[model samples]
Target: MSLSVVICCYTAARRVQLIRGVQSALEQAGDRDEILVVVDHNDALLADLRDSLPHQITLITNEFQRGLSGARNTGVARSRGDVVVFVDDDAVLATGALDGARAAFEDPTVVAIGGAVRAEWAVGSGPSWFPEEFGWVIGCDYRGLPACGERIRNPIGAAMAARRQALVEIEGFSTELGRVGDLLAGCEETLMGVQLQSRFPGQRIIRHTDFRVDHHVPADRATLRYFTRRCYQEGRSKAVLTRISGRQAALSSERSYTTSVLPSGAWRARRNPRRLLALVIGFGYTTAGYVTGLLLSTRSAAAA
Candidate 1:
């Protein structure tokens, strides 16, 4: 099947190191496959990317810089493929990954497939090991080894593929679930999955353990400050989404709530000779940030 790869990027100078990871995908993709780079108001970086890549890569400069969701929609509208793959500009796909993903889609019941993600810098970037205090918090090591028969709630947006028809029926990603500026709001992928499952029951959204991607977690994201901001954004956006999408959106909110309190559970393990204290601290901060963010979101909605 033909594949269309969509990558959304902004001003990513310091994170250029991640580009090498994306380049690795070229090795796996066929020459006829397409790469659409969506640049959200980053002209300089767009120029650099255009010059660096081959002519097969299509570059679209978002005139209004309408955030990640809007950019993805733009790319999807312009692309032509039986299957559409969304790869984070900063993530690199593993060798032979796409071939396996294509195989999984052969099952008519499988609507979407998520490739597992590994930390590119589990040692050098965050802490030498997973942070004990925040290990259970969002953005931590993904424990994706669910039983082969189990279905996942959501697919990580970084490395997901879906039938183009399903995406069209859903009308693309939601603007409410992605980040606003530097904030780290999430759950757009989960929201999309909800719609997919409801529209096509008995159709599974499987997680391909072997189809992997290396997510280059920037050093900034590893810092306490960045994580706190991410937690806050996630909390606030979730609350806002509930208002916009109704009670069903609360499912996403629950995930945000778990992100808030999970650190303490990890903390409890820390005292039992688990040395996961850092992860605990990360989760604590995440909870605090989510609470703060929810309040801010409520106030902002009232004002608007």
Candidate 2:
């Protein structure tokens, strides 16, 4: 029942905070636990980072740079815990999060459990009129309330844990989808979620309100350009997910005419039509990306 905390570190910018996250996890872990920080590349900070923690923090550096997905896979390979808890280098777990997660995964059917991700700077982040279904910009309850339940989709990568065996069975995260260099896009986690659901239909992918993590959204992500880019990427990823799964059912057509775009589209539209316009542009971009990805795949296959 030991827990393996896997923090995939690309650079040392987040080394300190991630160490704190590791320490927090160690404190909360009732069973035997070890922290495996997978460093994708070697840097001057490596020496200092190595000396900064207890022997429990095992640092595994790659000979060549592997991206986030690769680093995670590396960590998973080197870990010894039955449950592999993954937290982004920039995220810190809330008190008792690991304990709650342990209980959540006790059900044999449950393969994974994701913690509630609350923005550390939620005070002035955005208008409350945002949609909950949108995964690009995730923000849990602002005032620290226990908002727990079954999730319709995948949980944020900020804080989630899975049985090591299940992750191995699924082959871990996807290298094709997540942010590696400057891609600024993501869908690997969502695609994994879809696969998990397909393989284990009765098993509930529970989001434990009791298990929470604080994600510090950089100020750069608060701008309009960033939000729009995120929306575009999300739309693109949606198309990719649908194409891979062959599951398309007029995603937004179910909602009432007024609120079909997003949860807060109607509210924003009442003030300015830009909200609806944004939705249209997002969908168009998504369709284009999806078609382009499919065509490219076909071309590559033909060449092969």
Candidate 3:
């Protein structure tokens, strides 16, 4: 299947990482594949990319709302590939990642595919106090994911691919729930996965460990404050998603992660007080955010 790799950027701060990500896609893209760089309402960044990025990449400013989801929707609208793959501006695709996505789509039963995302921390490695269970807070694949390729509820947004038809069928990612500027809200991809499965029953969203991307984790995200804030934001995003898609669809994976994965992780980290404490704190922050978000959503519904 032809793949269209979409790399979206919003700031000049990640100019180097964005360039590297585009170059990586250019290198690994197949003959039938195409690369698109969507700049989310950043005129200066768009101009810079136009001058520096290779001519092979199709560059365009986001024509939709001002967030990752809208930028992605813009890319999908302009793309011509069978599979639309999303690569974060701060991430580099591993060799053969696109190939793996193409191979997986060979099975008509699969509608979406996500790969492993390894962290490339700015200070060499994550802080010693950071627990692996909360890696999602930093936008990297965490410890709770299945060890091998399998059908999954959803794919991480940092590096995931979906059938263009399925995306079109679902009308693309929602503008309601995703990062708007520096806001930590997310779960646009999760909602998309639920919509895809619901619209096309029996189709699969597979997680392929072999197809991977190295996501850059900036130093700012390595702090304790950022960790707690992100966890809380994640909970808020989940609550918003649950309101839109219903709890069962929005939180099936979270149920397993909270009940089985987290408890297991906490138990395994018993010997390491720091790690255990981090996990506990992260869970608490997330839970608090979810509760607050739920109340807000309920109030909004009543007001409506």
Candidate 4:
């Protein structure tokens, strides 16, 4: 099966790293695979991409809205491959990654394949208090995730592949539940995962630990402030996901993380003063965000 790898880009500051990510996709892809770069309506950034190290790479503007979900929809609409893989603009794929995705599709029962994502830290290492259990803060696979191949509810957006026809059947990502420019809110992937299973009852969402990519984590993201903010945004996004997808299933994993994982991480941090302090502060921040998100969602519903 042919593969179409789509990378959505926005800022020019990521120019060098974004090109590296593109190169990684090219290297990992088989001869039948194609790469598409979808710029999120940043004209100057789009123009600069055209000028610098000019290649025949297919580039397009987001046709629908100006957001992550919109750009992804734009690329999927134009992609030619049977399976379309969404790779983060800052992530670099591992060797033979596309081949793995292509192989998963051979089963026919697998609608989507999620690859493992490891963090490539710009600062060499993360803070002592920032637990690995919360790796989702950096968009990396966390400690509690399945360590081997298994059926999953959703693949994190970093490097997930799906059948083109499947995406079309479910009508692509929801326009309401994803990042729009500066807004960090998102759940489009989570919402789509729900639709994917609903649309095809027998098909499964698979996560293969070996099919991998290194998602770049900038130095700024390693900070406690960023960690807190991300968890808060995650809480807000979770609320949105609950609204779109049923709350019971939408929060299954989250419940596990909150009750079992976070508490365990907190207990583990008690030995270190820095870690303990961070745990207390981060927990409070996330709780506040969750409450605020729920309140706003309720208000919005009432107004509607």
Q: List TM-scores for all candidates, in order.
A: 0.83, 0.80, 0.98, 0.95
Ranking by lDDT: 3, 4, 1, 2
lDDT of 2 by residue, 1-304 (tens): 7788888777666676778777887778664888887777656656767888777678787533367777888888888898898888778888888787777777787777768787765346643433333334543332212247665446567887878877787877777667674456766666767667766778766667666787766666655566566656655665556566655422322233225435455444565555455545544555566566666666877999
RMSD to the true structure for each prediction, in A, is 3.6, 4.3, 0.9, 1.6
- For 68-164, candidate 1 gives per-residue lDDT tens digits of 8878877888888878888777778787877877777788888888777766653465554344334223343354235443577567777888888
Best by TM-score: 3
Clashing pairs in 4: none
**Superposed Cα deviation of residue 99, candidate 1 (Å):** 1.1
lDDT of 3 by residue, 1-304 (tens): 8999999899999999998998899989888999999999999988888999998999999999999999999999999999999999999989888887788889889899888999999999999889988889988999978765688888889999999988998999999999998999999999998999999998889898667899999999999899999999999998999899999998899889999999999898899998899999999999898999999999999999
Displacement of the residue 135 alpha carbon in candidate 3, Å: 1.2
**Backbone clashes per model, in order?**
13, 0, 0, 0
Between prediction 2 and prediction 3, the one with superior lDDT is 3
- Model 1 CA lDDT for position 94: 80
Candidate 4 residues 164-267, lDDT tens each?
A: 99999898988878888766676788888889989998999989766688999998898887888877887788777777777886787778877988788878
Q: Which ten residues in a row have the lowest lDDT in candidate 2?
A: 249-258
lDDT of 1 at 183: 58
Scored by Cα lDDT, where does model 2 land? Answer: 0.66
lDDT computed for candidate 1: 0.68
* Model 1 residue 162 distance off true place after TM-score fit, in angstroms: 1.5
